[model samples]
Every structure is written in structure tokens, then in C-alpha cells.
Target: MVASVPHDRVRRPEATACAAAAILAGFSLACGPAAAQQATSQVQLDEIVVEGAGGKGVAPAYAGGQVATGARLGVLGDTDTGKAPFSVTSYTEQFVRDRQARTASEALALDPSVRATQGTNAPFDSLYIRGFPFNEGTSGEFAFDGVYGVAPSFRVFSDYAERIEVLKGPSAAMTGVAPNGGIGGVVNVVPKRAGGDLTRYTVNYGSNARFGGQLDLARRFGANREWGVRFVTSLNDGRTAVDHQKEQAGVGALALDYQGERFRAWAYGVVQTDRFNAPSRPFFMAAGVPVPKAPDGRRNVTQPWEYSDVDDRGGLLRMEYDLTDRVTVFGSAGGSHTGVERYFASAPTVTSAFGTTSTAPQFYGLGVDRQTYEGGIRAKFETGFIRHAVTLQLSRYVEETSREFAAARGSYVSNLYNPVGVPAIAPLRIGSRPRLSDSTLTGLSAADVLSALDDRILLTVGLRRQTIKAHNYLSNVGTFASAYDKSATTPFAGLVVKPWEHVSFYGNYVEGLSRGDIAPATATNAGEILAPYVAKQIEAGVKLDVNGFGGSLAAFQITRPVGELSPARRFSESGEQRVRGLEFTTFGQVTPQLRLLGGATLLDGELTRAAAAANIGHTPIGVPRVQLNLGAEWDLPWIKGLTLNAAVIHTGKQFVDAANTQSLPDWTRLDLGLRYATDIAGRKTTFRANVVNATDAKYWAGAASFGTFTLGAPRTYLVSMSMDL
Candidate 1:
């Protein structure tokens, strides 16, 4: 067996501090040394002026740019949200940078329809969208540049992102088949690109001594400035607001691209490493134990010896060629390799309502490698007086995963309100390797859109054939436990009508796909493979745009089968879960000095059918009934370069179990921010500060889809300063 680190001997914290300091010092040298060298140059330098503007994939900064007017649509290319038949929101890079966001969860917290189940400091990133959970250690919910299996499998950060786009509903026709089958929608990230020649540096600090720095450099060369290159790197180290929290992370990315007359192509390479010590995990109360009040959000019960570490590497390439003025062909291929090791007391079995608990944490590790690719062709033509556009695409993905597991010596006793650590616990040695799972997904899709009446009306119809295969093994010492292969077809239709120039009415019927549930070992048909599942959705909405100040109101209903453990102890798909909700959203400027961004969702979710008759009409686990958010950014006329921002997010009470017997109270969170733009010496500079959970409210944030609960984050502060050379 492996020996364990003592409870009092945590990982070296000074090593992380030194690395972070070195990163910041390097950035300082890059900013000052180059200019000093230029001033002292003995030889004249010939700076060749490249002619023509280079291709820039990132959306340009617009007037009062808090949100993007449109987003890149898979196969169909970039689409204007006003003319699209779906509810879509794309947050710009400016919003992310000015808000001083570090992770995807913090950046998306303002969306009314979303709630971070694990709060912001947990090891895993989990969320609920439209009253459903898209969570797991490996969520597979994130898409990079409209492609899956490329982003980090465990979690995603915003260090190298240019923008984030969320398509609000089922999108089998728009994105083909997702690996996780996220019926609610897809969160896609656009990587930064090289454009104008420039170099930027930033220094950041947050609560609990968090400190870091970043370097961003871009350049273009070649005839017509057809070639471009960009590089970005960052490192940060600190303890979080939580007690004894230790965290450190480093990330680097390189982007290269070429924009020719008829051909455009780009590629990206990224690597990241993250580690945590004494990190907090969620609790799972026993069925008979009375639920206890949530403990202080800033307290930590984790053992100092327990930790989680992750290392990830990924690369991607995309190309597009114009076959003709009205037709184009495009293709993209990407892959990622991720390794994770976690040993923590994540399962908290409550022993009493007075805060006593029993814990038995284990060591779990996994490595996964994936390959994904897609290609498509799109063309536009005319049929009589109607204009038509057609697209055909194909995609495939494969992943191989292996894992190892070991248990600690004995259980440790602790309290939820006050904690104690037990010594003499030993760690296990890595004895063997096990082949865990291998999965594959392949799909083909075709779509057509027709427009008429001076482009006032549009109708789109699409279909996709999807196939999925999964293999599960009982470790390397045993035979395969199950092999599942399934196929299905999903179809969708949409209509958009513009009775006036600034008003549009739209409706759609779409479907999502997923691997079906199989019978458990207790069943007679144990190990049986089932067919794929298809979720259906119907939605309608109205959109308004008046000089860039606009919003949308939509109503939608979605239904899908859920897995269940029958009274007989057998597992099957016996419940039909449905969610019906109305969404209200607004964005853009109310005036030149004032901007607004926020929305609200009202949902009614229930189990329409179930083997347990008593649960048939019960509310589904973790589905919040209501959510609201409203934020404003105001440019101070009295202060030429200053802006003030604030937002509020509220989530209604939610059940934690299918029986609806256990529930968490509603929570309200507040955030405030400020920014000032000015010239420092001769370089452009910006100073920003933000505070989340300003009140330090102690509350359970919410529950994940699987009935696990996460405490809301504590009061946190973030500040940063950036300069350009």
C-alpha cells in the first residue's frame, strides 16, 4: 500500500507562489525590455508595412458592446439572432474581460435559466439549464468552435476564449449528435485569433491572496496580411475564500490562421494543468436522516491530504473554401487527451441532524483520449420566386477511457459545522490498470431553408441519422459487462415571420438523441442493450429589435424518458419527465449611457409516468420553479471613463429527491462591478473590480440532477489591470 501524507503536512504552497511570481515578472519584462531595446538601437530597423486588412474571426467590438448581435451556427455558418427561429445569446470577450471572470461558471452566472450546482470553487463544474441538469465529472456539454471532444473533459476556463454562445434548446439538426445528448442546448466557445499587431499584459488578484498574470500577443505577415499568429499564456496561484483552500492553475494556447481570397483556415493548440488541496465537496444525506441546515459557505471539512489534479492537452484545425459566390465547403477536425486523479471525502453521509457525519473517501483516477471530425457543404439557389439554401454535413467521434480505483483504510468521523481530522490513514498503491469504457458517435444531417415575400418569411426543415456504440468492461481482470449499439433519426422544422421591420415571430419543433438505459443486474434481462432515446421539443417565441435595444419572450415544452430503479430493485426507463417553461430575456443598450442584460424563467416540471405510482405526478429532482436576473451597465456622464454595473440572481426552492421529501431553500445572490478606461502614460489601459455574493449569504446554492447538493459561494472580490503596447 502507498503511504499517505500527514494530516498536517499539506502540499508545498510556496512552490506555487514562486511560479505565479515568475509568470508576472516575465510579463513585466516583455512589456518594458522591447521598448527599451528599440530606444537604444544602434542600427536602423526596416518595418515592412503589410498591406490590406487581415481576417479576424472574433466578433469585432461594437458600440457599447456588452453582447454579440449574432453567433456562429454549425454547418449554416454565422447567423443573425433576429432572423433565426431560436433563442440564442452570445456573450462577447469584452464582457468576460471587464467582469474579471476566471471560469465558464462565473461568466455564465448572469443567465436566468442557468444555476451553478457546485457553486464556483468546487472541483467539478455543474449547472442546470431550463430546469434540467447537464452534469457529471465529464459533462461533455462544452463545444469548442461548434465541435465536441476538444475542450477539457473535467472543466473549462475562459483564459483563451474569445466568446461563448448558448443555443437555448434541442439542436440535433443544428449541431448533429452531441456526445452527452444535452437536450437543453449547447455552450460553444470561440478561440481568440490574430488580427492587428499588438501585445497586451494583465495582472490579476482576488480573495485570499490569489494572484496571476497573462500575456497576449498577435501579429500578421505575408502578402495582403494573409497569415496571422497569436499566443496566450497565464498562471495563477492562491487560496480561495473557503477555509484551507489551495488552488493553482496554468494554461497556454497558440492560434495560427490564413485568410486568402477564396480560402480561410485556422488551427489552435492548448495545454492546461490544474490542482487543488483541501478543496470542498458536496454532501449526500441518507434517506432516513433528517436534512440539516447548510453550514457556513466559507468553511471546509476536507482533509488536508485529500486533493484533485488534472492535466489536459488539445488541438483543432478548421478550413473553409468558397466553391462559388453562392456556395461553400467547410471541414474541421480536433481531439483531446485528459488525465485526472482525485482523492477526497466527497460523499458525506449524515449521521444526525445536529451536524455529525461519517465519511469514507476513495482514490479515483482516469485517462481519456478522443478524436472528432466534421465536414459539410452549403449552397443557395432559387426555386421560382422563393430563395432557398441547403446544407449537408457528417460528423464522427470516438473516445477510449481507462481508470483505477482504491479505498482508504477506514472511515473518518467529522462534523458538518465543526470538523476533525483523523490520522494514520494510508493511501493505496497503483496495482493495476483497467479498461473502463469506449464510446463512439457518428451522424449525418441535411437541411433546407426557404425564404420569400421580400425575406419577411422563412421556413426550415432538417433531419439527422445518428448512431451510438458503447463498451463497458469490469476492469482488466474480467470480461466485458455490456456492449450497447443503437441508432435513431431526429427531424426538426422551424418557421420565422417578420410582419414588421423590427418585430419577428418564430416557432420550431426539434428533437434530441441519447443512449438508452439498460436493465440492471437485478433484472431478468440484465446486461440487455436498449435502443436510443429521442426527446421531443416544441417552442414558440417573439423577438424585437429597435436600434440594437431588444429582447425575446419564448414558451417551450420538452419531454424525455428518465431512468428509474423499480420497487423490485431492477433498473429501467420507466418515467416520462416533462418541463414546460416561459423565458423572458433582454440585451443591448437602453440608451447611449445605459445598458441592460438579464432574463427570467418560469418552469413547471413533473414526472408524467413512473413505475412507482406515487411518484407519477411528483416534481422532478433539482428542477427549480422560477429564476430571475437583471443587470445594468451605466457609463458615468459625470466621470468621462468610468462605468458602474450590478446584477441580481434568484432561484426558487427545489426538491433534492424524486419523492419531493427533501428540498433546499430559495437563494438570492448579488454582484457588483466597476471599470475605468484611460491611457496610462502612452499605452491604453483599463482597471476593473468586481464583487460576487457581496452579502456573504450562507445558503445551499442548489441541487444537481443526481440529487447532490452544493453550497453557494462565499463573498468574493476580483480586481485586475490591463495595458497594451
Candidate 2:
């Protein structure tokens, strides 16, 4: 048994403040001498020679400029890739290293438009992107290392990532399909690779008896520095604060690279396994009534009899060769296989009964197997008159899934007696049903960046043409088959102007398209085909890069028609939506020893049309009206090797149903962290302590269609230690 930290004991405000102040003082002392020396040297520097033409040569070459470049989050791309017509936010390894984010969902919580819903069982994570319900199978799409792959919904881990990028607005021009294209966004996760000398280890312990550790190692070899390798491994296990809940997980990954002056080869493999208990659903009070809690002050809806488990493994290979100084060729192939087995109890509520609730054993199993292969070749050529870049790509993807649902005989009790009275049910056996789908996409695109007007103004124009083929197979619906093939020519144009040294203004227009899949509605129309779905969006924004501060503001709008709803075999032409919003982000040093990073968003999302059967049109459920994040990091002069950090987050109220009859109230939360670092036994070691939800705020994160509400985690504390060699 493990001892638990009492919430009241950890909530002492004076102690928390003292710890934070000590850490900040330590960090200040650690850097005081160095900072003084640098300040003195700055007074003796010589005048730098002017280079290039125009006002660019008049700009000061300050060390602070270097920090501006290094402060970038690499998730946006390989480097400062520049902003697109749409809003894009990049979180770099520096940010991750400082926050100590444990999962992809945790990392994305900083973004206002990205919301995560934790699963009670398994490794499942659901997201609401741009006010639209998105899942792994739907509009919320995820990519790894800039490539598409199937990630297990129930069990997910983000230990081996370098950075995560969130691209707002429609992206059909890049990714071939958008099951949730109407929502307008995509998340790209960049994987860590074997680059630079690296050796790091970390261990963490949290309340509720949780403990875990991770190791990362990388090395380079060969005379020309042509070969490199990186390996990572991690393990975690323990019970959560929730009742009847425990979790255990393990992960491993290896990456290899070979690079020369003209060519590069890379390969990677990852495997992960997790077993965890799920949370119970919660009951909610009716409108105008007071909120309710469980008898034990807990809010679990599922009985203690059910649990969830998952296992995932996948790999990828990529190769690139420079045929010429202005041209390059690349190819990549990867695949993943996932299997899930679950035993749970599902019962209909008294309000609207879909089926009888039972304690009898029920089994639901799903196996998903997918493979993707893509190849592309591109060239960059410039003439004094115009600059152009062209790329042509062809890809094929295939996914097959097998699902089984069955009921067991007799009342089944695993650990405790049934409270609601178990039912003696007849034996029922359902054979496995299979679903297969395949997509072949071919695309050709060209973009030109022109500096036509004395190089003062820049314009980028591009176009893409794509053809998609889709096929579907289901075991229960006899032999129902249909094919959809269409080609779309999308064009994009943008303008960037620099009227002053510290400011840049830009505007852009881009088009997006999403292909729709067809399924048999009835035996008579089994051969009928539906038209492909398409979405379009436009956005504009401005960025300011002054000496001491930087910020960006953007607004966008997206529209798309609904496609066929899967499994239900129903057409949803009325599923039209429009989302428009503005985002503001700022990060920099307010003073020499104080730094701040924060942002806010105000947005509106409305469903212009609902399925004719429902006849409901209103603000989409789950899309909040306002979101905010603010944080500060400060260093003190008295202590050495320490730092203090604090942050506050708030989310506005949001509707919970299609008709906007029910709603979740606004919520606010606070977090604090203290860290100290020093060299011990010839190794660099660091310690960190953090409190999440410091106020023990109680709020509902979301609600399911079944009228069940999900509660957010209460106040919790964590401590961790890390070393570098």
C-alpha cells in the first residue's frame, strides 16, 4: 500500500509561495555572475558592417534576435517555416521540456480551440477541434512525423515526441481526407530523431501511488557522420485517486538515420502496451437544480465491475535523395496494427430506454489493421524573373476492421456482488463482423513565390489537382459496393508586406476539399453513389515582432456540407456548419528576469443546418465561446539553481445538446510549479514539484449524448527528478 497526500495538507498557500520563491532565487544566483560579465562585454563591441540592401541593413544585430529564432516551437516544421494563410501554432521541445507534458492531450491543453475528453477506460482520448466533435475516425485527424497513421483510440502515449503542431482551418489541400473536414484543423506530431549528442533520464512520482521513469539515448558514428541511432524506453504503473482504478503501461522506440551530402535514409519503429481501469460515468442534475456528487464525494458512473485494456505497435521508413541542387525525390511507407478487447456493462436509462441494463457479461472486441504507402518528387528552381516550386505525389491506403458483440449467459460477478441485481440472461453468441475500406489518392501541385514589386511585397500562388478512389465492405449488409472518383483543382494566394521594421501584415485565400464515402442505404440503392463532400475556408492575420514583445492575431471562416453517416446508412445533406473566430498569442521577456507566455480566443460556431429528421439549427454543442491561458516564469537573485512558474486557465460556458437546452458553466483553474537543478556525482540533475487545479475546482468538462456528464480531475500534486549526461 502507498500513502496518499491529503488535499488540505498540500493546499497550504504559504508553503507553496515559499517553495516558488526559493526556486526563483536559486535560478537568479546561478546566472547572476554570467549575466554581469555579458553586460560588461556588450559595452566594448565594435560597429557591425551593414550588409544587404534597404532598411534590412539598418536593423540591430542583437543577441536577443538569436533568442527570438531559438524560442520557436519546432512543431510548425523543420524551422521558422513562416505562417500560412490559416492560423498555425507550434509548440517546441523547449516548451515541452519546461512543462513536462506526459501525453498528447496534455500538451494540447494550452490551445484554446483544442479540447480533450479523457476516457474512463482504456487509452481512449476524444477531442473537440474548432467546435466540431472529432475522434480518431472522424474529422479530428492526426499525423505522425508529417505522415498519416492510425492511432489506437483507447490507449495513447506521447513519450517519444519532439513537438506537436496545431494547424487551424481547412487543410484538405495537404492531407488527402478529412472525415471531420468541416471543423477546419489538423494536428501534426513531430517524432524525436537521432540528432545531436543526447543522453537523458527521468523519474516521476505522483499522488495516488503513481510512479514512472524514462530513458533516452542517442549517438552518432562514421567518418562522414553518416550514421546515427536513438533509443527510448519508458514504464509507468499505479492506481489513480479514483476508486477501483489502476493503470500500467510500457513503451519502446528506436530510430536510425543515414545522411550524406546528397542523400538521406531514415527508419523508425515503436511499440506500446497499456492496461488500465476506466472511470465510471456520472449523473447530473436537471436545469436550475443544484449539482450532485456521489455518496463518497466521488462522481463515477460506471460500476466497479468493468475495465479497459489496449496494445499498439507500428513502424515507418523514409528515404530522400537530392537529384540536383534544385530538385529532390522522396518516398515513405508505414503501417500499424491494433487489437482491442473489452468486457463491460451497458444499460438503458429510465428516461429513454434503448435496451435493458444488465450485469450479465457482454463482450465487444475490435481489430484495426492499416497500411499506407506514399511517394513524392519535387523541385525548386528560381530565375531572376520568377521563383517556382512543384511537387507531385501518389499514395495508397488500406484499412480493415473486425468487430464482435455478444452477450454471455447467467449473471456474472467479478469482484463484488451486483448492487442493482444481476440478470439471468440466455446465452447469446455473435460471430465476428468485418469492415474493409481502401483509398487511393493522387495529387499534383505547384506553387510560386514572386517578389514582383521591388521586393517590398511578396505574393505566393499555388494550385493542386487530386483524384481519390474509395471502397467499402461490410459483412452484415450482404454485398453492397460503390465507388467515388472526382478531381478538384484548388488554388491558394497570399500577400505579405513589411511597411516598418517591427511589423508585418499578411492576407491569404485558400481552398480545401474532402472526399465522401458511400454506403448502401437499402437493397434497392445498393449500387447508387453519392457526390464527394468539399469544404472551403479563408483567413487573414498580422504579426508584430518588436524588440521586447511579439504577438499575432488571426481570424478565419470555414464552411462544408455533410456527408453520409457511416453504419447508420443515412444521408446528412443538412449537416452544414460555419465557424469564425479570432486568436491572439504573445510571448517574450517583460523584464530581464521575468518572462510571460499566454493567449486568448473568442469564437462562435453554429450549425446552419441539421439532418432533416432532427430539424435543429443552433450553436454546435461542445464549442466554447471564450478560452484563456496566462503563465509567468520568474528568476530570483538570492537562490541558485531554481525557478518559479505559475499559470491560470479559464474556459467559457458551452452548450451540451444540439438544441442548446442544456449547458456547461464557465470554469477557471490555476497551476503552480517549482524546479531546481544542480550537478550531483558528475551528472546534471533536476527536481520539480507541481500542483494542478490548485483550487480543487469542480466543473463538468463535457456531456455525452446519453445525458451523462464527465467531471474534470481534482487538485493533484506531482514530483519528478531528471538527469542529463
Identify the leading candidate in terms of TM-score: 1
lDDT of 1 at 209: 84
What TM-score number comes out for model 2? 0.79
lDDT of each model, Cα atoms only? Answer: 0.79, 0.58
TM-score of each: 0.91, 0.79
The candidate that wins on lDDT is 1
lDDT of 2 by residue, 609-667 (tens): 66644534576666678888887777666787687888888878766556576677887
- Give residue 101's lDDT in candidate 1 (0 to 100): 80
* Candidate 1 ranges beyond 4 A from true positions: 1-55, 59-63, 476-478
The weakest ten consecutive residues by lDDT in model 2 span 52-61
In lDDT terms, how accurate is model 1?
Answer: 0.79
* Backbone clashes in model 1, listed as residue pairs: none
